[model samples]
Target: MQILLVGAGLSGAVIGRKLAEAGHSCRIIDARSHIGGNCHTERDADTGVMMHVYGPHIFHTDDQEVWNYVNGFAEFLPFQNRVKSTTQGAVYSLPINLLTINQFFGKTMRPDEARDFIAGQADRTIEDPQNFEEQALRFVGRDLYEAFFKGYTEKQWGCAPTELPASILKRLPVRFNYDDNYFFHRFQGMPKDGYTPMIAAIMDHPNITVQLDTPYSADMTATVDHVFWSGPLDGFFGYDLGRLGYRTLDFERFTHDGDYQGCAVMNYGDRDVPWTRITEHKHFSPWEIHDGSVCYREYSRAAGPQDIPYYPIRLVKEKALLADYIARARATEGVTFVGRLGTYRYLDMDVTIREAMDTADAFLNCARRGTAPPAFVTSPD
Candidate 1:
């Protein structure tokens, strides 16, 4: 089997590896000069600290299988993601935890009392929440929502909370305990080296040939036996149904002598504040010692024609457009769409890898059975 993988991101790299191991000849191509997509990391020339070229991607997952798979490539150091929010002109912890609630209200309340208090603050009248605003009001009340989430959400999504879906707010952790571990994942850590080297190792295979400057297209539509596209789903069809909405980031880089923000990630929760968050790359891998630190103030905006697509804003309107692409992709032959862009969803690094693994497994199975692989491994709709 001859496979041509577009977009040399984690999805493309992982799937390419699997296919090559399964005795397929795969050639992975990426539009960017380098591979690893958004997860690309490199050592800072000035400080020598590992830098996230796109944004901060902390590897945290509950799946032992995913953890083990990544560990096979690079050693991971135990790291807990402790996030802070700068809002109402003050610093506070996130996830509405006990310490955060007590600090915000200037009261020393117990766990049960804080939980009950927050519940009381929530909008009891909202029997059925519609948008992000109403959902947050129903879950954590107006005060917390406004101070911590409202402005940040607006900036991040480029829309008012009322215009967004409630499901997003549901994934956010809201805890009564004092615990401040940002994610509920069982395994939480940073790659000992960096993501770039790890991904490079993955792409270094006998049968896999990576073409960095080349982009996949209809020109070779008949050349390869199958195409594993990890680029934007809309990009694949040339946005015939209209461009899928995406929120892209703008990073304002700065170098400070020591401890710029004093944290890995700081959420700026004021509409007045332009940037959504500031990430101190040094803190991401605290195992590394550096005298000076580099930081990125992240600004989110609607993705432009040339901007790198980050988060998929799959709203109702975009969902309808995606449905058209889905239909078109299904009708198309010899293509298996995988990864964040293919599925048109915002996914963590681990989820992206897991999906690619599943895709390769299923595709291989179908091939062995002399059948066609499905248009998608995961569907947003």
Candidate 2:
């Protein structure tokens, strides 16, 4: 079978590799000059730091199989994402941990005491929260919500928390313990060399052909048995219904003589701060030391047609448009929508890879059974 894998990110690379290994001819095309999509990384020539060109992407996953599969391509160094945030001229650990709670309130309360105190602070009137603001107020109370989440969420998504869905705040855990680790995952690390190399290795199979700087068009679908699209779902249909809401990032890069921020990520939770976070590239790979450092001050805004879409703002309107796209996609033949953009959801790296592997397996199984593969291995809705 001749398979056309669109977008040479992890989703395309993994699926392409799997199909090629199964004796199918796979051609992976990416609009960018490189692979790895948003996870693309490169060594800073001036500072010798492995720069996450897009932003910081720490690979943390509870799935051991996905971890091992990625490790097969490149060595993953042990890395914990200890995130910090600044607000009102004070620095605090993220996820609103015990330390942050204690520091913010200037109280030496234990975990149980903190939990009880926060419970008291939490608004009991709202039994069932409908939006992000209500969820935050119910979960962590007014002070913590305003300090840690409100401004940050507004800047990140470019909208008031009240307008956003509760599901967004539900993803972030509010810890009563002193554990400052951002993610609660079994496996957490970054590729030793970089994501580009790892993705390159994934697509290096004998039966796979990679075409960088090549955009896959709907016309190209005629030449392949199947198409695995990792690009935007609305883009596949030329956004006939309407453009889905997405937030894109802009990085203002600069060089420093030595340590900058002294951490991999430092977010500015205060609305006064223009940029969302400042990332020091050297700190991401603590194994290597450099005399100078490269850093980026990231700014977030609504994604334009030319901009690379980062976070999918699946509000009510976008969801309606997405439903229309999904219906059109399902009715169409010879194409399987996979990954974050295809599914139009904010997905972590592990979920993307796991879904890609499952999609590949499903396609292979369908091929063996002489049946048509489903339009979606995982439903967008």
Candidate 3:
């Protein structure tokens, strides 16, 4: 079978590799002039730093299979994302750990004491929090919420915390212990050479052909047996229903002779700060040393048609339109929508790879049985 993959990112690369190994011919194409999508990285000729072109992508996952799958392509270097935040004229540890709790209130409380103290600080009046603001206030009370979350949440989502859903805040945890590691995954690392090489290695099979800077045309599908689309779900339908809301980021890059922020990521919790976070690219590859540093001050805003869509805003308005697109995709034949953009959801790199592998498995099984493959392996909802 001849397969047409609509995006040259991890989703297309993984699925294409799997199908190609099974004696299927795969042609992968991307609108951008490169592979790896947002995970694209390049070396800074001046600073000799591996600059995360779009943004920082740290590979962290509990799935051992996914971990092994990526390591097969590129050397994996140990990297734990320890995030920091600045607000109210002081720098503090993120995820609200014991240190942050004690320092913010100026109390030297132990783990158990801190936990109890935070519990007392919480607003017990709101038993069931409805929105982001209520949830944060109920969990950490006014002071901590305002200092660490309120302003940052408002800036990141481009709206007041009161308007955002509670589930967004639920993803973050206030730890009683001093474990400042951002993710709780068993396996966490960065690609030694960067994500582009890993993705290029994945698509290097003899049966696979890659075309960069190739926009998806309706006529291309006529030549292929099946289509795996990793582009935006609304885009495939010409966005007739309406465009799904997305948050795009604007990165302001600058170079520093020495260490800039002394960390990989430094988030600004004060809404008045304007930018959400500053990422030091040199810190991302601590294994390699360079005198100069490259960093990006990230600013988030509502995505325009011309902007590169980053975070999917699945607010009430977008959900209704997403349902329509999902239904239309199901009715369409010979096409499978895969990956983050295809489903219009914010997906981590690990989840994206896992789903792509599973999608390939399902496709191969269906082919053997002479049956139609699913339009979506995982439900968007």
Candidate 4:
């Protein structure tokens, strides 16, 4: 089968490789000049430091297969993501762990006492939490929520916590202990040479031909046996159901003589602060150091058509539009929509890879039995 894989991101590359390895011909196309979508990385021409083109992407995954698969291309270095935040006139550890609890309240409460104290702090009135602000107030109380999530989230999503869904807060941690690992993934590491080489290796299969600056259009469906689309689901149907909302990022890159922020990621949680976070790419790889340092101040904003979409804002109305697209995609033939953009979800790199692998396996099974592949391997909604 001559399969056309759209968007040369991790998801597209993974599925393309699997199908090609199984004796099928595959062609990978990307809108960008590079292979890796947002995960694209390259060495700085002037300083020789590894630069994350689309801001910083720290590959932290609990999935052993994801770790092993990525490692096959580039040896990964042991890296732990220790994020800090600047809010209310101070820098503090993230995830609101024990350290944050003690520092925030100016007390010396231990793990158990901190848990009890915070439980006491919860807003007793909010019995049924509806939005993010209410959920945070009910769970961790006002001071912590306002200090940590409220402002940062508002800046990131371009809306107050009350407008956002509670599911967003549910993803964050309010730990009783001092464990500050931002991610609970079983396997986590930075690629030895950065993400670009790894993704290039993934797409370097004999039967796969990658076309940079190439985008797969609906008209091409007539020639190809199947299309694996990793672009936005709404884009595939020309937004006939209306554009699903997405949150794009605005990065302001700067360079300095030495280190800037103490940690890799330091978020600004105060509502008065304009930017959400500042990322120092060098800190992602602690073992390496340079005389100068580079950083990006990332500000989240309402996505425009020209800006790169970082996350799908799966609000109520957007979810409804996504459902319509899913139905339209199901009715369409010879295409499977997979990955973050296709599904319109905030997918970590690991989940994207795992789902792509599964999607490819299912496609192969149906193809061998002379059956048509499903319009979508998974639902975007």
Candidate 5:
């Protein structure tokens, strides 16, 4: 089978590699002159630090097979994302752990004491929370919500917390203990040589041909047996119905002679602070020593047509538009939408790769059984 993969990111690379290994000819193309998509990384010429070109991407997963699959391509270096937040003129550990709780309140409470104290602070009157603000107030109380969540959430989403869904706050955990680790995953690490090389290695098979700086067009799909699209779902249809809402990030990059902020990520939770977070690139790879430092002050805003979409603003309005695109995609034939942009959902690297592998498996099975492959292996919703 001749497969055409649009966008040479993780999804396309993984799916192309799998199909190529299964005796299919795969051609992967990307509009950008790189392979790894948002996870693209490159060395800073002067600093010698491996900079995450599009912000930071720390690979962390609970799935053993997904871990093994990435490890097969590149050497995985042990990395635990310990995020920090700078709000109200002081620094605190992320996930609102016990330490953070104690520090913010200026109280030396034990685990049980802190739990009870927070429970007391929480608003039990609101039994059913409707919005992000209501959810935060219900779980963590007013002070913590205003200090840590309200401003940050408003800036990140470009709306008041009250406008956002309560489900967003549900993803964030308020730990009773001092486990400041951002993610609760079994496997967490960074690729020794960065993600670009790993993705290149994945697409290194003889049956796979990668062409960078090549954008996908309607004509290109004519000769291919199947199309695996990792680009924007709305873009596939030229955004006829309407554009789905998305939040794009703007990074204000600066260089320093030595250590900049002493951490990988320092989020600004205060509404007064224009930028959301500042990422020190050198801190990402702590194993290597670098005298020079590169940092990015990231700012989030509504995505424009030319801007790179980072986070999907999946509000009620966007969901309605997304449904229309999904319906149109379902009606179309010989195309399988894969990855974050293809499905119009925020996806982690592991989940993206896992879905790509599963999509390939399903396609191979469909080929064997003389059946049609699905438009989506995983639903965007």
Candidate 6:
């Protein structure tokens, strides 16, 4: 079978590799010159630091299967994402941990004491929280929300927290303990050689032919037995219904002597601060020693046609638009939609890879039985 895997990111690369290994030929096409899509990483020519081209992507997942699978491609170094935030005039640890709580309140409270204090601060009147604001008020109360989340959320999403869904804030943790690790995943690490080489390694197979700087078209779909699209859901259809809402990121790069931020990610919670966060690229790979450091001041905004879509703004309005695209995708034959952009969801790296592997398995099974694979292994809805 001659399979066409569009978008040479993790989804397409993983699925294409699987199909190719199973004696099926794959022609993977990517619009960008590079293969890793948004997760593309390369070493800085001047500083020799491994720079995350799109943004900082820390590979953290509880799935051992997914963890082991990625390890096959590149060596992963132990990296814990300890994020710091600047608000008002002081710098504090993220996730509102006990340290942050004590620092913010000027009190040395233990885990139990801090937990009770936070509980007392929480709004007990709001029985059922609706939006992000209500959820924050109910969980961590107004003080922490306003100090850390409010301004940051406003700048990040370009909307009021009251308008956003509770699920958005639900993912964030309010730790009572002093553990300041951003993610609570069992397995957390980064690719030693960066994501680009790892993805290239994954796509390196005899039967797989990757065509970089090539965009997939509806006309080209006729040439292949099946088409697995990992591009934007609305983009596949030329946005005939309407463009789905997406928040893109603009990075301002700057090099510095020695250390700049001292941390990998320093989030600016103050609304006055134009950029949301500044990431020191060298800190991402702590193992590598460099005299000079590279950093990026990230700014988020509504994705334009030319901009690379980062986060899908799946608000009520965009969900309706996505539903129409999902319907169109389901009806389209010889096409399987996979990954973040294809499904219009904010997916972590592990979830994307797991879904892609499952998609490939389903496709191979269907081929063996002389049947057609479904449009989506995991439903967008």
Provide C-alpha RMSD values for all models, in order: 1.1, 1.0, 0.8, 1.2, 0.8, 0.9
lDDT of 1 by residue, 128-204 (tens): 88888988999888898899989998899888889998888764357888999888889989888888888988888
Write one digit per residue (lDDT tens) for candidate 2, span 72-136: 99999999999999998999998789999899999999999998999988988988999999998
The 10-residue segment of model 4 with minimum total lDDT is: 167-176
Candidate 4 lDDT over 1-381, as tens digits, reads: 899999999998999999999999998998889889999999877666788889888787777887788888888998888889999998888778999999999999988999899989889798878998988899988888888888888898888889988777664357778899987777788988899899889988899999988766767878788898899888988877778888888889888888887788999988887888899888887889787888898888888877788888888888777778888988988888899988888888888888998899999999889898887777665
lDDT of 5 by residue, 213-281 (tens): 998889998899999999899999999999998999999999999998888999999999999999999
Candidate 1 minimal-lDDT segment of 10 residues: 167-176
Error of 3 at 377 (Å): 0.3
Quantify all predictions' global Cα lDDT against the true fold.
0.89, 0.92, 0.93, 0.86, 0.93, 0.93
Query: How well does candidate 4 score on lDDT at residue 69?
Result: 85
**lDDT digits (tens) for residues 89-186 of candidate 3:** 99999878999998889999999999899888889899899999999888888899999888988888899899899998765369989999998899
Instruction: State TM-scores per candidate.
Output: 0.98, 0.98, 0.99, 0.97, 0.99, 0.99
Candidate 1's C-alpha runs over 4 A off are: 171-173
Clash tally, candidates in order: 0, 0, 0, 4, 0, 0
Better of 4 and 6 by TM-score: 6
Q: Name the lDDT of candidate 4.
A: 0.86
TM-score-better candidate, 3 vs 4? 3
On TM-score, the stronger of 1 and 6 is 6
Q: What are the clashing pairs of model 4? A: 61-187, 62-185, 62-186, 62-187
